[model samples]
Target: MSSLHDRHRAVIPDWITLYYKDPLELTHGEGRHVWDAEGNRYLDFFGGILTTMTAHALPEVTKAIADQAARMIHSSTLYLNRPMVELAERIAALSGIPDARVFFTTSGTEANDTALLLATTYRRSNQILAMRNSYHGRSFSTVGITGNRAWSPTGLSPLQTLYVHGGVRTRGPYAQYTDERFVDACVADLEDLLGQTRAGVAALIAEPIQGVGGFTSPPDGLYAAFRRVLDRHGILWIADEVQTGWGRTGEHFWGWQAHGQAGPPDILTFAKGIGNGMSIGGVVARAEIMNCLDANSISTFGGSPVTMAAGLANLAYLLEHDLQGNARRVGGLLLERLRAVAAGVDAVREVRGRGLMIGIELTEPGTDRPAPDAASTALEAARSGGLLIGKGGGHNTTALRIAPPLSLTVAEAEEGAAILEQALGSI
Candidate 1:
């Protein structure tokens, strides 16, 4: 029989990439560790691309899923779904947006798609403002607005998207400016771009931190500054919190909170962590904007009972245990440890992030050029040392992404950091 990897390659799209030169099939997981097909245990630092919010095989989420499945697996949005309504109620109350309304989807892509539909319909325009070095989703509509050329496969788009500045703080044209000046420069650029665009631009959608673009983020209050300019033109602001939501950033519950001077965004999209490993995505917006559609829209599996239960239980566990505090405490130590490690390694360019979402950028020694090869080496080395991490960047995947479950312990963080240090040493 052919190997599972070979079988996968034969059936799956070639563009669907897998990690590692020699892939290892993960069989099961618990807490912050997972076992491979051969029963090799490894510390899971990436948390399945930051989707596992609390931990693998979390009892709360598992029981919720089981109990809900035994009752009713799914009921389309046409009927009154109690679980969906309950989850929505919790999310709305948590969301800072006034008169907030929620709509669920199966994945982040669909959530973002729904958000775009709402924004475009409410504003009556298809022109969108997106930040450079950003990755929203994989769907045609989301792809069109994505500014990262590496991920964007085509120029054809349903919406006319204009890329904005300030999503990336380290290597952009305004990188030399101080934090305050950087905000001023980016806001001025946004104003200038708005002047050049046609009237009635739909919305400006952005990630508080660019996840796929190697966890990059703008200076705090940058969006608040942009919000002032956007208000003048009546363009909506959509914060895509898919990867940075639910206290992943530690200092703030929502990534947009860092830019709270102008208040909550007009719209917000979230996914990845809320349901742990289960598929759950949603959009939250003000009532007027959410209810703007003249026609009806429903997601058959968007708010499925099982997924909602998982989300609710996962969210409860996250809050009740104060995983955000854990992320802040443990992540701070990990960040400091990694920085010290990077300081000793010449190929390591920079270590940046907050909470459990940290990134280690690799570059050619003594030069600013991205060293994707070095990143690959580090990845393999980490795996060999019984740890699993992820790699992503704007310049050909040159940064290592380290986002363990929010429940990550200090001892686990120390172990992961030590393995990462050894990996960097190998590179």
Candidate 2:
């Protein structure tokens, strides 16, 4: 341990600067709070970017992981693993998609990659459509479908793939169309794209609630209408719920549910909340997509016994506590308080999101810059004041993203909000 400390004193990697690396070296966590190496306690409102759903060092999750590790850590997913099978069954049951098939991966990006591949391969087409301001993953194929141009530099021209109007519910480079007009325009563009291609399009991937896109949600009737268009064009609908699934959206188990859509997506991807800080993600598909998969579809380390155990434990804890209900209850309280705070501060342009996944958009007076600088400053201030937060959005990365653990107490919520309020005041 001392040798490790000495090595760390020598030099840190350049990649560490890429992210707003917090000064507090996180040593450990319990519940919604983490401790730094210096033994300072800080509230974790960000939840490791919303991955620690059940909170850090949760007893159930820790015990399960330890037990599994003690027993057997790796049993190549090629063989049967009870924990994996059981977790998959539970996920399928929770998703309410009858006869659903599950494929696991190590991260949300991997799950998304699998879903994209499955969609294109099942339909045997190269054309795919993704909404603007969307974020799927950093991989080549997934990045190709991401609409944020800044994510891929001009030199990476090959990454710039076909795109349609990202729906016009909210204003940006795309005109703000009425809900009906937005749906019609998106449908028309998709149909036109499909027609222009010699072979039919493969899939249309979208986030039920755009996570890194400032928590932007689709308009009412938009999802159903989009599904109708996809069905008409014989294209598959892939809901990228990597950030919005697992009951984070207080209204329903999945963000898509809030849209009141009747049918399920052909392929659904999930992560973030699966392992409660452990890396786990997966794609659940219906017969149409799953039937096409062969031996090559398996991920070498995807559903290993240890990860499966972690997922099972985390999910079990979530369900047992009815964490979904807690998210709704606490989220409602948090939202109300945030809205009130926004009203008090003119810098806050708007507050949006469902359940625990929420965003507070900041804007400057008479400036097109949506107060992104202020947002960054506020985040830094909040960290110094003992709270963690995240930022997202395209041109305007001014939205303060908050996704605390499901088990966060009402008082803890108030404390977190108070920290944000103080940070805003300082900014």
Candidate 3:
């Protein structure tokens, strides 16, 4: 093992997983590629788990951070922060909820935690409805709502969490049902669960596309159907858009837009790509829920000027370049190419996703069983071919995840796809 790898294993907790048999030490990146310490460059398909939304080493974001750092780095949430205010204004305007309020945090876990706090306080209950195969965050409360058994450790939780269905369409009991019928069944299941619960549920938190759950999703309007039920029961809906926000899906700016008929969610949580690698996370809620907490609270490192400036610049760059449109056009072509390549491969179970967020589920050759070994082999092979990808799934990490930077060019997509196809063949 390399000296650095041995040292990393000695210092970092084993639970903090690293990719590859030989853990890679990436020194820097530009555009859609990164170079390891050894000077080997690889096309980055995963984009640091979708955090590098725009591009690697984006000048706008870098300059923003540098400029802000040269001045005041932070004033905490105790004072009026200009950059924070500006960024919040942009987000509030974008949030569909009328009279929305924005709360910033350092990570998605904190954002979701704050959302849970607001929801539970507003409704006066700790009961929550969560989707099956969901992966929210790794906090005490967030993990309770995270339905993926692989991620959730210990069954104990502060709040009562009920796991719902319809997140994964092809592998569940309802896999054979038509889209409309599947949604109806999940909704009925939700209502039945509601009937069984004695206390009022605080909220229903879900990721539109299950990111760590192998990028799985129910039918387009499944959440909309759930929203209708939530309205009747006075339960709030929280969209965990950590991975699906910022037009990554191409069709919608926010993942909940796929369920637009039910209107905007009562609350929304975002992280990952918003700051383009700068640590930023937040919760957006209407006045009622946001104002529910009677006591004042503060996040010391929440809205640091440097991160806010980074977010502002990143948002501007994304909107100006219409990166969402690029994700659509380029991602569409990439998916088509990948699907064609997978057609002749038996180990590939499915190719599904939208825009830059795509997933390739692997199975034993000519069989439906999840082939995690195949996925691992393919990941190593992809890296060997100078491509970096990610793998995740509730079912033993059996899916190859391909989510490139939103600024991914057609040529880059083609290159990544070619490398991935060869990797699959090698597996």
Candidate 4:
């Protein structure tokens, strides 16, 4: 018999790099568990980068897609579909935003690109402010705003845009002034940057919980104050909740709501969990801001019946099951456990995030300073122990992301945490 790794390597196609490929081959999934080709089951903690909120092959979502596929598969954007309308209405109602209007897209990147285009078109301003370490998408325009220098070879975008420090104000590449004075300084810097620009800014895009930036959640009152600053400068506030939205954050249907009653953003974008991995994305903007895109905007396969059905079914599943509440309750437990585990590890520095979006900041064992590759190595160890995780940070993967599915149960979470503890111990 061939070795598992050898067999997989021989059969696997080579069109793309098998990043982190192991001997195990995932065959199928149900709920939060995945079975490999060898029939050994493993718990799924990463949840397809936090998109599989309702879990894999959810019967309801599958049935909805099947039912819709049987009725009508595709529809042009020029025509309206009931599934689309229903999903939009349900999203609007659950989001607590009256008269919510939605524009559909194929993915998060497309949605972010659409939002950027619409903002520039409406404001007629090329200058925009994106938070430091923020990740919008990989599209050209979205990439222009992404603050991860590793993602962008050039220091800054050639376009007329600026990246302002966000999150807890700190130093280094992902500096987020955590202190009030630092935040004030950041605000001052923003003021100066905006003043230097010839025209007013179009928008300031930020993720409520910096998912790719290490799940950084800024201190309370920051967003409300930032909104005031934007109001003063007549700039739009765009909340990119692609990772934090759709009931994953708990206590709020959208991550923006968890930002401590900060005034509602002028625009909001979501994607990851919206379709439960069915390739759907959209933007919910205030009617006023949306009107800016009314002139020259069109979506081709945006709200197709297939995607719309998935969106509707996913939304219904989330609401009926109160997945958000589950995330909060379970996330709280997970966070507490992670913090306790970190407390025991001299290399563990901090644990941060909201709801199910958790991050473990690792450091050198003795100095208690950041360990460049320690976190990444720990993630590898965790993978070996059958737990999948994501890594984030600026240059070094110093942060470990634990954004499991909303359907993760207490028992599974306890097992994952135990395995994660073992991984940390090994590191």
- Evaluated against the true structure, the overall lDDT of model 1 is 0.93
Model 4, residue 100: displacement in angstroms? 2.8
In order, candidate lDDTs are: 0.93, 0.80, 0.93, 0.79
Candidate 1: residue 395 Cα off by (Å): 3.5
Cα lDDT tens digits for candidate 2, 46-110: 88888999889999888889999999988777788898899999888877566898988988888
| lDDT of candidate 4 over 240-321, digit per residue (tens) | 9899898787767777775655667777888988888898888887676777655655677898999999988888888899
Lowest summed lDDT over 10 consecutive residues: which window, candidate 3?
391-400
Error of 2 at 309 (Å): 1.0
322: Cα error in model 3, Å: 0.3
Off by over 4 Å in 3: none
lDDT of 2 at 308: 89
**TM-score of every prediction relative to native:** 0.99, 0.92, 0.99, 0.90
What is the Cα-based TM-score of model 4?
0.90
Candidate scoring better on lDDT of 2 and 4: 2
Better of 1 and 4 by TM-score: 1
Better of 2 and 4 by TM-score: 2
Candidate 3: deviation at residue 17, Å? Answer: 0.4
| lDDT tens digits by residue: candidate 1, 1-427 | 8999999999999999799999999999999999999999999999889999899999999999999999999779999999899999999988899999999999999999999999999999999999998999999999999988889898899999999999989887888889999989888898889889767899999999999999889988999999999999999999999999999999989999999997999999999999998999999999999999999667899999999999999999999999989888998999999999899999987899999999988889888899988999999999999999998898543799999999999899899989998999998
